[model samples]
Target: MSNTSEAIDNDTVIKEFIDLFAQQDATTLAPYLDQDIVFENYGSPVVKGRENVVSLWAEVFSTMERVEFTTLNQAVNGDIVIAEQIHGLALPGRPFAPIKNMAVYRMRDGRIVEWRDYTNSEYARTLM
Candidate 1:
């Protein structure tokens, strides 16, 4: 636990983290990450460390003209949170259909310690 005084419910932390992603602002997202955070995308290598994770988001954001995530459902169990969402993305010249995404988050001291995203590779490939 980094700061007990600032600790919030793990569910809230995960919800807010997902909300912040819609804004596509990595700087705003940084405070919600633990220093040693780990982020794993569906088909990519694991990203370790807060800075590395944030940088990855920044890169993704830069390539998108618009990004939105609509939560279909969310569930919480202790410090673990699971969110099911439809991710809407728009690139410069292509319209990205909403893609189903499932993310699991682990919280510690109001910050995200780990995040793993699962997506349909076949559906995702069609968007490219």
Candidate 2:
């Protein structure tokens, strides 16, 4: 659990954090991640540490021509926030596709300590 005394609005934090992905600027997004943050993408090996996670996102953002995340619903419990979202993505030459996704975020000291994303890998592969 995170420091409950911080009076953190975890829902807002998650919303803003996810919104940053649309900008595709990892540097701008880095501050929201804890130094020891852990990130796991669907069907992918877990990535540990903020730098590594940032690098991974940077690489992904490079390949993306456009990115948008629309949160269909959000639930917050203590230090965790769960979001159901449709991630619209467009590669350099490909058209945008709205991919259904569910993401779990763990917050500590106002930074995201852990994040796990669940998505339809088979459907996502069709866009790749």
Candidate 3:
């Protein structure tokens, strides 16, 4: 890939990463996740393993009324990717929760191996 093409590919990966969270498509998501992957949300346990990650989302996606994301920026270098985003979740009759967060992903072999999410209390209510 040319320099610019590679950069675009990285950008696409970052965008797709957010899309995966919104879609909660575990089958499609598993291949891009590493075996020892670590995933976190504000209130959930630190999720590990590709299958575990898939399983967690599988269970969570079942109850979703709607999930949406608006990414603010992605900063990527080598195997590190950081994306800042605003997201909202609507759960049936409940009011939508607005969340502001930064997602940190460690990529290895072009797949996410470790991930962390950072946000403050009220700003993290969507993760509930």
Query: lDDT of all the models against the reference?
Result: 0.83, 0.88, 0.76
Candidate ranking under lDDT, highest first, comes to 2, 1, 3
The candidate 1 region of ten consecutive residues with least summed lDDT is: 1-10
Residues 1-128, model 2: lDDT tens digits: 34444334888888888889899898977889999999999799999999999999999899999988899999887888889999999988889989999999988878999999999999987976
Clashes of 2: 0
TM-score of each: 0.88, 0.91, 0.81
Model 2, residue pairs in steric clash? none
What is the C-alpha lDDT profile of model 3 across 1-128, one tens digit per residue? Answer: 35455556666776886787677566878878889999887566888899998898787667667777778988876667788987766777777777788888887766888888887866465355
- The local lDDT score (0 to 100) that residue 45 gets in candidate 2 is 98
Q: Model 3 clash tally? A: 0
Candidate with better lDDT, 1 vs 2: 2
Q: What 10-residue stretch in candidate 3 is worst by lDDT? A: 1-10
How many steric clashes between backbone atoms does each model show? 0, 0, 0
lDDT of 1 by residue, 1-128 (tens): 53332334776676777788679888888999999999988789999999999999899899988788888888777677789998888887888668899988888877889999899878876985
Name the candidate that leads on TM-score. 2
